[model samples]
Target: MPLLNGDEEISGVLRKYRNIAVVGISDKPDRDSYRVASYLREHGYSIIPVNPTLKEWNGIRAYPSLSSIPGDLKVEVVDIFRKPEAVTEVVREGLQLKPRVFWMQEGVVNREAADLAVQNGVDVVMDRCMMKEHRRLLGGK
Candidate 1:
């Protein structure tokens, strides 16, 4: 199926999937990745930051990669912050983790990656910010 907008389906996925593995999260507070992660964390969703370069952010232990996260960590969504060219690899890794959803941030879209995710039975959202969607749909701020 082609990528869908933030309608009922998208909102349902987000509402149903609570834990999120935030790939490409930055240490800098000014970055979109950081803000998104913070928003998710504050809004009661478990935020697991995936970045090889950081050990921790905002008191949360950061995993180097999705595979490195402890097996017990329940990841419902993989919210990606990387570029379009880099999304496929992240999506591939996300598939291994078996998250229910794969979300590419605004300005990041990869048809191949999105297709791979859908083929694996994972819901895909592209070119949209998870934070914005959460605030819009879930009344999160």
Candidate 2:
């Protein structure tokens, strides 16, 4: 199998996992990361915000990095919103959590990062928006 899978695998990922650590998430409601995270949260998925710039948002504490989220949090998915160049580091750190999936949000792609995640027994998705995929594949808005 390739480092990243196709749509069928993506749909299975979206359906099977719910705890998402949104890296590079912005507190600003207008930002794409915030919007995507909020969408996921509204759809009944747990959203864990990860950004060094914030201590917390709304009420849930925002972790500074994937490595900082508590061990008991059970992050099922690591949804990355950082630039392509920054993904490798995030993937390396998030591997510790042993998440089921490493998802790079729309326009984000790093083959190296994806390969590392796949090699470690995690599914990978690159350059795709989870919100959009859910809507398209699962018949959401």
Candidate 3:
């Protein structure tokens, strides 16, 4: 059976998982990564920033990598914002944490990485905007 599609499925994912770790999150307020992360956080979801350069972002302490996140902290979703070519590496790192979901933001799709995540029993959502989906599914509550 294939994974569910459409707003229902995407909405289900957003509701099911709240601890979202945004990989390649940018510090710039104008960046989509930052905006998405901020939106998710405002919606009562825990936001974990994964960036090598910054020590912190949006008031949350950022980890240099996915693996660097505290062991006790189990991330539910890995929201990737890197380019397509860089997604594979980001997904590889996310695998170490064994997250429940792997979400590649809009315009970012990596078949190899998606397959790998699926093989590891993780739900994959690729080429979709997390913020848009959330608003659409939940009626922007």
Using lDDT, give the best candidate's number. 2
lDDT of 1 by residue, 1-141 (tens): 446674797788777888999999999989999998888888888999999999998899999999898889999889999989999999887787888888899999899999999988888889988888888887886
Best by TM-score: 2
Candidate 2 accuracy as TM-score: 0.95
Candidate 3: RMSD over Cα atoms? 1.4
Return the clash pairs for model 2, or none.
none
Candidate 3, superposed: residue stretches over 4 Å from native: 1-4
Distance from true location, Cα of 108 in model 2, Å = 0.8
Local distance difference test values of all predictions, in order:
0.88, 0.89, 0.87
Q: Write the per-residue lDDT of candidate 2 for residues 1-141, one digit (tens) a residue.
A: 344557788888888898999999998999999888888888989999999999986578999988889999999999999989999999999999999889999899899998889889988888999999999998876
> Model 1, residue 86: what's the lDDT?
90
**Candidate 2 lDDT trough over 10 residues, lowest sum:** 1-10
Could you tell me every candidate's TM-score relative to the true structure? 0.94, 0.95, 0.94
What value of lDDT does candidate 2 attain over all alpha carbons? 0.89
